[model samples]
Target: MPVTLRPLRVAAAQAESVAGDLDANVATAVHLVSAAADWGARVVVLPELFLTGYSPQAWLPELTTTPDDPRLEPLASAARERAVVVVAGAAVRRSGPDGSAQRFTLSLLVVDEAGEVTAPYDKQHLFDTERAFFAPGAQGASIVVDGWELGLGVCYDGCFPEHARAAAEDGARAYLCPSAYVAGSEHRRDLYYAARALDNGIYVVFAGLTGRCGGLDFSGGSAVYDPEGRALGRAGIISPAAVVADLDPVEVARVQAENPIARDRLGSLGGRSRVVVAGPRP
Candidate 1:
């Protein structure tokens, strides 16, 4: 006989954040986490810089969060209570290249089902404007949830094919992208997610921010793309919503077997990008 388990359901979420208001934003995040779990999702990903609302205000010293920051405790508790893994975004501090001062890194903090958080997975690729505000992370990262090895990346990180390819080379079955796209930039999200999924034969989940933040407006385009670059699920534009989908390991294996991209690839030519894995989630 064979052992059987529950289906692997995951969700991508978007919410309108209260700029620079940690209390309100954290509450909204917790609510969304609960909503995802209630929908039978075992893992959930939220938009980038959600805690500080992706505003210019993110550069402020008060907006930085650490893995164990008390402000995120409620969110960890929510994941623990719901028995789901929550990949959430925040502005976290990291030593500057000069090592003289601390700067921010757009990062994802993984909250395991036990309410413990793994160290932040900072964004590896920073957009043009972001390069001035944040220091790019040194490498890629992945986290395990209920035995699924999922890759991690922030907004612009997905734009680079090497980022996702490295994760696939490092054995990630799914890529969780927490992103934010301004009003007219929605098309970029679709193209990148689909490209990444097809290029690496891996599932891609996108969580985008919605509504106004600072002087800009964002259109939520949360979606999930299967290994063949097909849209498996999608959330409405510019409104708070969660895109939920059931990930099938068998389907992933089938795609990889048929495509052989991972096997025939010229030996991880994506250059020195190392992928760090977080673990076997309970």
Candidate 2:
């Protein structure tokens, strides 16, 4: 590979969170951020709602936090020190219509290498049982990391082809999904992301949780798929692990050039209203 076109090293962290234990979860996330950074990952992705442990029964208005919350300072410190962007999930508090009240949305937090935290994607599709506890976001979001545009998605959001298609149409090279997939449903998790990647001819990453999370056993099948829908690395099931892969830009371009799906698609569709630039390209 030429120095001008270096591959991006990304990581998916699979870990167990203590239900409703925000402090412990934050600490664990900070540690994982460091681990990924030490392993030379320029971007680190964690499971959805890992900050709050993903328990609907324990849900409270107070569980929702803004990006400036002090509890997330440790994560910021780690990201800044390690110089790696951290993409994780949290229950974000948002103002309601006409300032009526605050609504909690399951959001994907883009913690940049500069320690800037932004909630660009709020998870438009709520999974089974999630509809009862969370509100769907308006649309999709994409972020630019080191010149490569990456689409953001939560667990259930990865199932929709339209969602990934829209992002790819809008110039996303990869989709980063933060999820908490339960046990026994491992097949769905396995199929959804791979299909999405191949369908769009883009990279797809699934970061999953492991062990017991909110009274459910989360299966850790975190993986990274190239444009050919091939797994780049092996991840453990029901074990805390970090799955890492080096994504080559040249390969993505080569595959997209050969694949005609993007050009064959009908009229352009709107996707990813928000565009976040992680930082300057190295």
Candidate 3:
């Protein structure tokens, strides 16, 4: 007889964030985290800029804050009490060097079961409109938990294959995307998300913001996909919801063994594709 490993239960949350309201947004995230935990999720993902709302055109500067801000304590407490990994989004302010202006980054903060907060993983690729208000992050990031390497990506970052590919090369078993995508872009999600999973043979979890926030209407298509690019669960386009799925390492192993794309690429592509070292994790 052999000891078996339990499948990892992950949850993707689709919720609305009120612009410029930190306390309210944190409360919402806490509630969602609790709900996900109650459903036995070991990892819970929220949408992009969920803490301050996805206000790219207005009120960005006012909503930006350092990763250590006390306002985020409630989320940390939730993660600690629930014993789950919470990945939430926010705009992080980083001071520039040598008297340069402060730079704001669209970032994801990872909270572990011990209530520890890791360094922020900023969005490497800024959307067209986002460039005006946010600076692009320098490096990608991933965290290892319960024998799984989970990669982090913001909304626009998922559009670029290299972003997710880099994480896959660095040993990520699953990719988590936090997005604030708008309506009328269903094709984008349908195409790219599946490709990302199929191309790398890694699980992909997407959490999108829903409802109208400010002047933008979000396309709430939160979903989780297996390594074979099969959707395990999905949420609606106009409602606040959550989708959860149990991802088995055995399934990932079976897919990778059958496909071997990542392994075969190493021989044919030479050095064109290389492992990207992610930023430090908690």
> Which candidate leads in lDDT?
2
Shift of residue 48 alpha carbon in model 2, Å: 0.9
| Ordered list by lDDT, greatest first | 2, 3, 1
What digit string (tens of lDDT, one per residue) describes model 1 on residues 79-142? 9899998888888876658978887788888888999986558898888777777788888899
For each candidate, the alpha-carbon lDDT, in order, equals 0.85, 0.87, 0.86
Superposition TM-score, candidate 1 onto the true structure? 0.89
Instruction: Give the alpha carbon lDDT tens digit for every residue of 1-282 in model 3.
Output: 755656889999978888878898899999999999999999999999888788765446667877678988999999999999999888887876875678888889888999887655999888887888888899989987787888989988888888889999998989999998888987897678878999899999999998877788888889999998988888977455789999888888899999998778754534566686997789
User: If both were scored by lDDT, which would come out higher, candidate 2 or candidate 3?
Assistant: 2
- What ranking emerges by TM-score with the best candidate at the front? 2, 3, 1
TM-score winner between candidates 2 and 3: 2
Those runs of model 2 whose alpha carbons end farther than 4 Å from true positions after fitting are 1-5, 96-100, 266-282
Compose the digit string of candidate 2's lDDT tens values, residues 1-282.
644657899999878887777788889999888988889999999999988887786467787778988888999989999999999888888886887798888998889988999899899999877787789999889998888889999988889899988899999989999998888998888999999999989999889988887778888898999998998884767455788899888888888889868888868677758778697889
Using TM-score as the yardstick, the better of models 1 and 2 is: 2
- Tell me how many clashing residue pairs each candidate has: 0, 0, 0
